[model samples]
Target chain A: MSEPLESTLKPGDSYVQSFARGLSVIRAFSAEAPRQTLTEVAKRCGLTRAGARRILLTLETLGYVKADGRLFALTPKILDLGFAYLSSQPLWQFAEPVMQQLAGELKESCSAAVLEGGDIVYVLRVPARKIMSINLGVGSRLPAWCTSMGRVLLAGLPPAELEEQLARVQFHSHTARTARNLDELRTRIAQVRSQGWCLINQELEEGLVSLAAPIVDRNGQTIAALNVGAQVNRTPPEALLEQCLPRLLEAAQSISRLLQIKS
Target chain B: MSEPLESTLKPGDSYVQSFARGLSVIRAFSAEAPRQTLTEVAKRCGLTRAGARRILLTLETLGYVKADGRLFALTPKILDLGFAYLSSQPLWQFAEPVMQQLAGELKESCSAAVLEGGDIVYVLRVPARKIMSINLGVGSRLPAWCTSMGRVLLAGLPPAELEEQLARVQFHSHTARTARNLDELRTRIAQVRSQGWCLINQELEEGLVSLAAPIVDRNGQTIAALNVGAQVNRTPPEALLEQCLPRLLEAAQSISRLLQIKS
Candidate 1:
């Protein structure tokens, strides 16, 4: 596939040839393939090995990648690039306190997540004590349809865009309880919208349940969703709806207020 | 002065071209100027407005930046880029547990930092309880001369390279106690090497004291440094040395062992 538009052009104008290639090499590393040989990178990125070598060498010189013998993997220094983004974005800053207070008050694992294509990516996560079996962290991602956070975000999308996304998604069974068809997904999203929140039971993985509410900005656009997950053994759907939804919406609104002030 | 190498390249290597520019734009947004105008970006990066615009437009399209009317600022989505780096680096994965334990034991803010030019950029930070006045989270950068983390990371450099960094640094005081001469910096780094740790007092900011130790991989290269910080009122230097050094070294060794095992 051709590279996405944002990954290709500056905005309207000039191109710096070598620099773009270097960025492409960094992007090639992902969750499944954390490290890549030069030839592997070349094949994945459609670049020659020598071209990839120049980019890697440049990144290595900049302290972004460490090259041992022949294999190339990213160095922790690359976090500076990501840190540069996070430290500047006001959403995480605004969400931090609200999520912490709500999570502490509720005694559940609370998180704030944003949409990333067909996945929901966790930006802020406050893990509950008593050792939950799931090892979800701040940067972890999961399929949208299988998560409460994802469903809330999807429900906020325009009808046309949501339909297009539903069409594109391959509905795999993450758990027996996961929504596996477009019809079911559409119904669930509609219900979530009507109820002003979503409560998902064992959809992502067995034994886990989550409730999510949309966080809207001044424009009333859902930029993110705030969710709380509990082990189903501890809190069933009834308790979740009655107790968690009110708190979740309150926290989401608090975060949204903070974001508006920041903007 | 010219556009950074990562922001250039052509469409035939489209992945390479776009990735570099995207990375460069992320780099452009720093703590010094979290929000930047197009002209500022162009001038800082040595790009024409036309060149910078294409990259910015691409970034906007990807939902990494929100160009609120005219002023462009990053959105939380950009954290994905940095998270990509941290999630992949095994050193962080290994070091986090030890760092967390050390922080718990000491009741102080502990960080694992690596050197970048004249600054020390934090790759990992386990913050202290009791609420610090300053909100120095992960990814924040501090001057190397005044910070214990920076001194330990600087000790990794060869003597000549160390001297070069000192010469380039404009030693402005963040606090009255900060070092301002090349000789003082040399002496401090040499002392850090000899002692196998660094303890800096109120150099970066008044009342901020930190103890740091170097972390070496199996190759015996100083890949990173670990530090714990608190108010001088909380833990005096004598108590810190007596109580913290042994645990810090133990934590460093644990990280080193993990790095070697993973490698």
Candidate 2:
């Protein structure tokens, strides 16, 4: 019997070269460009037209895409990609109702997020209203250390991993309030851990103030965090902490209990 | 300097092997298994453990995945995969609020959906209450012929493509009410086109009655369908047609106007 020699890869190592390239093609679609011609996709993904055509065609055949004459775009069926993740990811299910409740209670956009390398990937975002200036919708991502959720999640990381993660990214000042020094970031994370909450005042964006609290499982390990954000004019940092923090903490506790109940 | 090769892929083919394999790995994560050990992934993807490991690790490095010890799971960052579709797909933006408002006004779930081959995938689903038996979330797919939205979408499809799609799937009945014959389906679609709407008594599930109207863009081409679903007891078929049809049609018109509005 002959066996296919699957490439040997270490933990966290790269594998399946074609797969990575294919993903690049998919990633080429953005808020600005949802529908693209084959030439645009090829240019975006750095693939030859023939190469892009193959992937797009295969994807179309697989029902992940819908081709409209010369234009190629993803269909709603493509949502199955993320749907598969949300259906399987227990944290999203647990965080959903809590985020919804938090959004209603705070009258602000409340979201649950986890740190992914340099970004805070929003798992669940219960938006408060339409015409949000931030435009950070569910499935949107922002630099982790720059946001309240990122600070809280970073605070929860083990020392070695935390250091490793910090080392990987070149800390640059995004706003005047953003911490540019590693020592300062370390101190900030320590404060966040000790305080059991993190507040980013105009760090990510001026006029966008947010407060966050860590969500820990029964094991006391922080798996996720809840963050509430609003415009600075609508709710100042003082009001956010005073009015929203208690309810946020309660929701976080309830989410923790739910996670434990499932486990 | 050598010019880059243009990627000209046919509808039936793919060019980037790595991209295909990578996407297949991403697709491998589903409702049944969100997280998997390296060995499990290898088995599911038909790759050697080493091959799977590299892909998984690379994904992890890319911030799309996270590994806790031996088990790996997709990160919420993965929603970027679908969010890309939602944010870029211009039709849903116009339809989302209209669908939500219609759901509220009608006191039933309202959705905007497009057809995908033999399936009707929900692009936007506005829920009535927090709890429903069907987790018919956005991006969820159901067999099209059995659904009002599906039927409407099929009615819009060119006859040749419709025939091809019909010939492909085994008309397995989801419920006793499901139409089992291809001829009956064709007739139903034609009637839906002629009548401007489709009503399914309980084709997909018992007691689930739905009324749907086509959502056409300014070009008057059916891009998707707007539908309302409720318990059979809540609204008799005749009443649903009388009461809900106008609202559905009105909402559909509003959405069309919104899509055509200059941003």
TM-score of each: 0.83, 0.84
* Local distance difference test, each candidate: 0.76, 0.76
A96-132, model 2: which lDDT tens digit per residue?
Answer: 7777667756778788887766788777765563435
Give native contacts recovered, as a fraction, per prediction: 0.41, 0.63
lDDT of 2: 0.76
Chain A TM per candidate, in order of listing? 0.85, 0.90
DockQ score of the complex predicted as candidate 2: 0.43
Q: Number of clashing pairs, model 2?
A: 21
Worst 10 residues of 2 chain A by lDDT: A1-10
- Runs off by more than 4 Å, candidate 1: A1-21, A30-36, A58-63, A103-108, A127-139, A232-247, B1-23, B30-40, B43-46, B58-77
